[model samples]
Target chain A: MEKRVTFRGWMLPLLLILPQVVISAVFFFYPAGQAIWQSLFIQDPFGLSARFVGIDNFTFLLSDPFYRASFVTTAVFSVLVTLCSMVPALFLAVLADRLIKGSGVYRTLLIWPYAVAPAVAGVLWLFMFNTRVGIISWYLGTLGYDWNYVLNGGEAMGLVVVASSWGRISYNFLFFFAALQAVPRSVIEAAAIDGARFWRRFFTIVLPLLSPTTFFLLVVNVVYAFFETFGVIHTITAGGPQQSTTILVYKVYADGFVGQDLGSSSAQSVILLLVVGLLTVIQFKFIEKRVHY
Target chain B: MRKSLIGALLASATVLSPLAAYAETEVQFWHAFTGRLGELVKAQVEEFNNSQSDYVVVESHKGNYSETLNAGIAGFRAREQPHILMVFEVGTATMMSAKGATKPVYEVMAESGATFDPNAYIGSVKGYYTSTDGEMLSLPFNSSTPVLWVNRDAFEAAGVDPDTDLSTWQKVGETLTALKAGGEECPLVTAWQSWIHLENFSAYHDVPFASKHNGFAGLDTELMLNGEAQVKHLSAMGEWARDGKFIYTGRRNEGGANFRSGECALFTESSAGYAGIKAEAEFDFDVRPLPYWDGVGNAPQNTIIGGASLWVLEGHDAEEYKGVGEFLAYLSSSDVQAKWHQDTGYLPITAEAGEATRAAGFYDENPGTDIAVIQMTAKEPTANSKGLRLGSFDQIRGIIDEELEAIWAGDKSAQEAMDSAKERGDTLLRRFETANN
Candidate 1:
């Protein structure tokens, strides 16, 4: 039998859902509609006048080699951030789950990084890895290694990726820890009594049980890396060293705010919106099937 | 009834006080100066405010250059723009392209009956902000030119003579090689790499950085930065980077710290760096005219300005425009300009100010302080050296910076990088043309 909460009338249901519908319309639909409208016109910075360009912005963006290059950059960056953040978070969550004492202390300490803003986190990393005066780079220099991220695109990417993922690990850790605790201890003990080793039990029983949380985190972290890591990239590198770290969202910000090319930026944002929508749909359609609950 | 009457009386009093004090017109000025420079601007505002009672100029710091420009644009959209907006040199084209949004300073000065003289300003500094028809569009402020700064202590320590002539890139290179052999960790470092190296290099070598007379002739212009002189200069710098004779610190002023901390032996930076270098640097230093390539003909031409200017926006009242005119007149006055020039390391925008400072022996008190003004006014700037007026220059500089970084990393040759920058930058120019035209 299916369980449902039934309303007395359609009016009641509509009234109950009215707040969310109003919010989505105002915040999401309104701006999205405006962006689509604005993307069709080119205007000066002052917006006193506008010319109807009619898809020229989109056509230009699609044909530009730099915009296409940023797509691959965004993919690589998001994947790296998600993996680097989640894998360590899962390991720490598992270790904390096995702890008998001081788990609260460890958990509280692990949550500290999540409180730091991305821009501040970026500054912290930038200071330590500064090519000229940074302590870490200086130490590396003393160790007979010349560490110059200012010129080296590979090193610049590595530093930003690490900085972007650092704060995210705590966020992932919090959710994973809660899920690990909610996993029934009796089932794990039963498996242990059946002569399954720690690793074997974790792989066969605990892993499958945590799949729902993992899937949710996968989607959340991918979105986080795509949109929210902009502060890290902007503060660390202003998308330089040959545009190696110029992700799609950063391009939107640079063009819209810095470059003041609003038409192109709005078009880029519209494309980014569609890409995110498609990704979410794909995740729900294919990846959600593997979720245990 | 008594309480309501008291509330109504208090509201009336609040409204009446503003009416009494509202006799003075307030002129809002937004700028992008901070630190020592910010303090000077505040002092200037307070002085102007104290000088007269007709207009009260309220100045606000609105973040850095790009942020302030964006804020001004956003304000215009919201119909709340300041009376005046200070834009950096590169933002010249963007401001010019916004045809109806800005009210030219010449029109303001003329309509308000304020004392105005276009010839008062230094030619090169004025040329950058002037329209094609020879009208002053903005009030030039805090203009600076790049110059070579030598750490004399480092030079003496390296057994190289501190007084060696570094008028040419060949000599600078030789000096850098010696500084490197002296075990100097940072032989040479630069701030604003594209401005100091490429843009100034082209102008100083008397080569066209862009066609259409550096965008002064028409809106349709293409970059000529990949020409022979620019590439040869960059190639030399690339070789120096590869040999570890030069350090690539950053795109902006991150190299400033390196230079100020006495880690760098030679710095190519704006003359405005003097104020900071004066206070922070413990060792002896000297400023020299920017070096030019020896191979280029008629080299060592005048370099371009790198600082900002104040532009008046439209939609302001005539009373406010009159105040704007007076405030600008006060700012460009000889005494005020000379004092500003003496206090900070910026070039005096007016010839009278430059003369007043010299007459006051400020330049004598500080040796090498006049090099920037001398370098900039060395000759009548030819078409090549009058400074760039390219549209979408802020983004184009990003492309130039990326390509320059590639050369520093040895990922691409100077020729390849400059060619790539030209191609990328031209696309932005075309877009800017389409939007503006």
Candidate 2:
């Protein structure tokens, strides 16, 4: 049966949704439309003059090797960030779920990192891992291990991934903790009574029940790693050490703001928008099928 | 009726007050200075405001150089730009090509009927912000050039002569080898790697960094920095890096921290690095001319300026223009320019200001401070060594930085990195040409 709330006057329904429609149109549609429009033109840095060159920016970006390399960098970065953030968050959630007292204190302590801004978090990590004056770097040096991320591509990528994932673990932990608490005690007890071990019980009953949460988090974490790690990469590496860490979003900022190549930046943004859209569609289409609820 | 009568009386009294006699026109001046520089700029503004009764100049710090330029552009797009914008030297070409967006300083001075003389400015400094006919387009402010900053105590500790001659690259190399042999961890480090090591390297060697008179003659310039001279110099630096004689710090000025802490024996940085070094370093240091390769023809021609200048944005009212012109004239005055040079270690843009500083014995009191001025004004700038005026220069600099980093990391040879950088940078240049031309 289909149930609907009907408004007698058409004006009331229109008025009820006017704010959301206006917000979406103004903030989302308008700027996206502008990017699409601007991507078709090449303009001076100051916008004093603009020439219409339809499809040229997109074609140029597609043919550029650096832009293509950024795609691979983004992929590796997103996968690493998702795994690093979610695995520790799940372990912490499981540990907190087993606690009987002071769980609130543990949860509060774990949730504090999310309060720090991404750029600030990156700076904190950078200070600790700085090649010249960092305490950690000094310690590593004493251990006969030279740690200089400024020139090392692999180390630079690792530093950014660790910094980015460190900030995101708190958000993932909160959701995972909530989902774990909601798992029924009786189901676990019944499995225990049937002589199943703790690990077996968890794998059979609790883990299956948490599949829906896991799937949701996977999608959310992928998106978070994709769109929100720009500040981390910017403050830490700045897409250097031979462009090893120049992700898609960071490239947009470096090209648009730093380079002042607006057309290429807009084209890059359009491509990133399509990429996120496509990923979301794929996640909903295939990955959600295996989710329990 | 009583209340209305009271209101009318109050309005009349407000209009008749003595404080309302002169309505001072406000001139908005946005700059990119912070810390010590910021305080000095504020003092200058306060002096100007106190010296006048008809104009109030409101100065604001608008982030760092690139951020300030972006903010100015965004403000212009919103029709809320300040009357005066301080742009870094790299943004000269962008500002020049922004045709209707800015009113040239020469036009502003003439239209406001202010006493103006273009020849008062030092030629090499003014050449950066001028037209082909030698007309001043922007007022050069806070100009600086690259120089070698040597830690004398470090050199002495390393058993190298503190007064060793380092005018040529070969001499510097020998000094670095000696410093390394004497247990110095970092013999040499550089800031603005691409700027000091390549761009200025080309200019100082009197080689073309880019074609078309380094982009001054036309918009069709492409990078020519991968030539034999540049390759030889960069290869030497690369070899130094492999032997731990040269430290590879982060791209911009991060090496300053090491140098100031006395970890590095020599630093190639801006002449303006004096202020920071003086404030931070506990050891004796000296400023010297940037080293050149003896093999290159007539090496050490001149190193170009790297600081910023003041550009007058268009669409301002006539009265504001008058205030801007007056402020610029006041800023270019000999006393103010001399004090700025003495306090900040920037080159005095005006020849008169330089003379005044010399007369006051500022250079003699602060030994080695005059090296930058002498390096710039020693020879008339040639077409190859004047300065680069290419569009999309900031982006090209980034490409060059990446390539240089690759070379430093031993990922690529100097020739390979430079070739790649030139190819990548040329694409941006071509795009800039198409967009602007």
Candidate 3:
């Protein structure tokens, strides 16, 4: 029999969720609504007055080749960051789970990067890969690689992806490590007794069991790559080397703040909001079906 | 009884404090300066505050240039704008077009009965922040122009004459080739790539960077940067880049680090790099006027300014305006301006300030320090030489940077890059025109 607690009244339950509702309303819904409303109008920088232009801003953005290019860039960046951050994290977490000695030290060392700010991570990688003075760049030059991210679009994109993913690995590692530890010992022991090789046992049992955690991380990492990598891009590249790394969020910031184009920026934001919403729905509808739990 | 006595004392203190505060009008000044520059601004504010009892000028450091401009705009939206806001040269057009948002400096001076003369300022510096009628719109403060910064030690090590004249681009190119042949790693690097390389390069060559008098005459101007001279100069630079004679550092003075570290033989950067180079460089260095292409038409016209100016935001109280006026006058005084110019390496906006600095033998003491000022004041500015006043210029600069990077990377020809830059930048200009006009 299933058991559940019943609230004394709807009032109590509503009161219990009031703070969250108010927070979402004020912080998320209101600003999002305002952006949508502002997307339909053009205003001067001073905010003295505005003129409504219906869907003109949207039409202009849709017709802009640069804006369309940013969408493709954002897609590529998101996929690369998610894979780079998650694959290394999963590998490290598995190694950490198997460790019997000094595991605490190794885990602590692995988790240390999570504390670094994204911008700081970007600067750290930039110092290592800087064209003039970077040690890595100098080493690469000696190897005849000639690393110059400032002029090379591919190198710039790769640098930002690595820097952004470097900080996220620790977060993903924590979750994967915890999930790996939670796997039932008896199941693995039974598999070992059945003469199954370690790799086969892990693939058949532990991997399938970890699907739920992996799915959760996938959604989270995608959102992070989309929204939270702005600092890394701003510091490392400023979306440069020929706009090759100008992701959607960075373009929104560059257009709105630097260009001071409120209408176009707002329209871009509205489009981003819709893209995120559709992505979230698709994730739940398609990707979540693969999760074991 | 103790609580009641404390409450009574607090009430009396509050009543007396208001009366004391009411005696002086407070003026808020927001600036985008940090580090040594920040300290100098603080000192200036302290001097102004100490000079008067009726008005107190409170100064705040508000991030870098772009961030500070955004802050001022956001504050204005919230109706909490500062009395005086420091806006960089790129923001001049946006500030000028925001009707009823700012009080013209000339009007502020006249209304406050402060002794004012627009002619007291240097024409090149003042023209950047003036109206079409030659009225001063903003107070020119901390103006800087781009110049050639050479590391003498690097040149000497490269077997090139340390005192070789880099007056023309041909000479600069030969020197760069010599430096590269002598095993120098970085022959030339630049800061503010578009500002120094393209915009000022155009002005110094008496060529228009944009149509309609570089956008000063009207709002419907388009980018005119893809001219034959510009293409020629950029193609040469691109070839030099391919030969490893020119190093492409990250945009916006990331090259300054390499230059100041004595790794680069020649650096084209702002004159304001003086303060940083002075503090950081271990080798001998000197400033020279920006090099121009000899083949360009009547080359080496006056270079334009790049630093920031002070605009008076509207909606402040009358007394606050008076305090702001008095503070501007104090800031523009010859003693203050000369000291600021000498200490910060920014141009003396006023002619008297330049004279005072010269009389004090500052220019004699610091050789090449006057190159920026002399380069700027060499000739009365032509229509093409006066600073650009286009809307969405900052964004256009970003576009230009991207295109220039493509050129340096050998991914696109100079002609193709500049043509694309003009087309893309013109769209933003049209958007700006539709929005503002």
Candidate 4:
């Protein structure tokens, strides 16, 4: 039996959701519609003149090898950022969960990186890894290993991925730690009495209970890696060393704002929108089935 | 005739002071200068304001060059553009293509009845921001050209001559070898590699960087940067990069820090590198002319300029434009121009300003301060040596940077890289042609 709070009239429900609908329309839907419309035209930097090219921008983008390469780069960056951020975060969360002494302090310390902006995190990593003047690269030079990401494509990609994931790990740690605390104590206690080891009981019982949080984080972090890591990529590599580190969002900024190619940039964003939407749909359709919640 | 009339009104209005002038026209100026340069620009605006009671010029420091141009365009779209916007050299083509967005400087000067002499400008710098018929479209505010920056301390430390004659690329290669063998980590590092290496390289060697008189002749121009001269030079640089003589730095001026810190022996950077090197270098430094290939006929052609210029935007009234014209006259005055050129290492745009700076002994006091000016005016510019006027050049430069990086990384040969760059750049040029046409 469930208690239902049915709306007495349609007006109240509409009024309750009005603010949300308005915000989404203004911030999300309107801009998305504008991007789609703008994609069909070519214009100078000034909007005084515009030509209706009608899908030429999209055709150009799809035909560009560099643009196609960026799709692969974005996918690789998203996966690397997700795995690198999540594993260490889960480990830290599990370690903090076991702490009986000063657990709050440990948890607070673990969550501090989330407060840092993505660009700042990138600069910090850049300072340590800069080829000529960086402390870490200087030490590596003393050991006789050449470290110049400015020329090496693989090194540039590796550096941007690490820099992008640095702040995201702190965010995932917060969610994972909160979920770890909410696990039922009775279940762990009962498992301990069944001659099961701590590792086995934790994996089989506690980890299964944290599925909903994990699934949610997976969705959020994948979206974050796709869109929100532009700052880190820009500050660290600027999609350079032969465009090896050029993620999709960074290309959007580079083409649209920096290059002033608005039509092609809008076409790129529409493609990115479809990509993320399809990724979300796939995740919800398949991955959600495995989640107990 | 109209220009002279506005010039007369400006003089009479000033002479009459508060009685004759009913209103002080407000003129807005947007620029992309910051730090010491930003303060200097603010001071110039203040001086202009203080010098006149008939007009007031308000100067705002927009973000960087790209941001300032975008802001001007966005403002134009909103019908709120500044009276004048400072645009970088790469954006000249885009500015020219958008016919209604700008008010040509010659027209502004003519219509406002302001006193302006087009012949007063240096040919190379003036040629960059002009129409095909030699109509000045923008005022050349702060022009700079590429020069070889040498860190004397690093050179001496590597057992090389601090005053080596680096007149030709052949000589530079010999010095680079000596510096590397003497245990220099960075024998040669450059800022704005594409500018110093390829674009200016083509100009200095009197080779076309693009077809159609380097795109000044027509919109159908294709990149000629993949020609024999350019490929040969890039190949030599690529060989140096392979031998650890030419250390590749980050794309922009990130190498400025390495050079300033005495980590690099030889730096190929803008002559305006003077501003930073003067303030920051703990080691002694010197400026030299950009090197050229030894074999080309009349090889050491002038290098092209690489700084921002002032272009008046549309949507401003005639009264405000008179203020703009008056302000431009004040800015290009000998006193102000000499001071700006002496302070920032930018070339004095006006010939009178250069002569005044020389007459005032500023050049003698500052050893290498006049190098950029001399290098720019050293020869009457040929079709190949004048300047690039390609649309979508900013994006084209990005493609060039990418391909050059591949050459430096030993992933592609110089010929292959330049060919790819030309192919990629021509595509953008075609797109710009269709869009603008």
Name model 1 segments beyond 4 Å from true. B1-22
lDDT of 2 by residue, B1-437 (tens): 13344235433543553332347886878899999999999899889888878887777777889888887887777667778999998889989989989999999999888787888999898889999998899999899999999999999999999899999999999999999999999999999998899889999999999999999998999999999999999999999998999999987889999999999999999999999999999999998999999979579799998999999998879998999999998998888999999999999889999999999988889998999999998999998889989888888898998998888889899999999999999999899899888
In the range A122-195, model 4's lDDT, one tens digit per residue, is 99999999997699999999999999899998888889889888888889999999999999899899989998
lDDT values, one for every candidate = 0.90, 0.90, 0.91, 0.89
What's the TM-score of chain B for every model shown? 0.95, 0.94, 0.94, 0.93
The candidate scoring highest on DockQ is 3
Give the interface RMSD values of the models in order.
Answer: 1.1, 1.0, 0.9, 1.1
TM-score of 1: 0.96
Q: Can you tell me which runs of candidate 4 are displaced by over 4 Å?
A: B1-23
Weakest 10 consecutive residues, lDDT, candidate 1 chain B? B1-10
- Give per-residue CA lDDT, model 1, range B1-437, as digits (tens): 13344235433543553322367887878999999999999899888888888987777778899999998898787677789999999999999988789999999999889888888998998899998789999999889999999999988888788999998989999988888888787889899999999998888889989998888898899999999999999999999999887889888888889889888889999999999999999999999999988879579789999989999999978999999999998998888999899889999999999999889888889999999999999799999999999888999999999999999999999999999999999999998888888
True contacts kept of each: 0.77, 0.77, 0.79, 0.77
Local lDDT at B259 for model 3? 92
lDDT of 2 at B388: 84
> What TM-scores result for chain A when each predicted structure is judged separately against the true chain A?
0.97, 0.96, 0.98, 0.97
Model 3 ranges with Cα > 4 A deviation: B1-23
Candidate 2 TM-score for chain A: 0.96
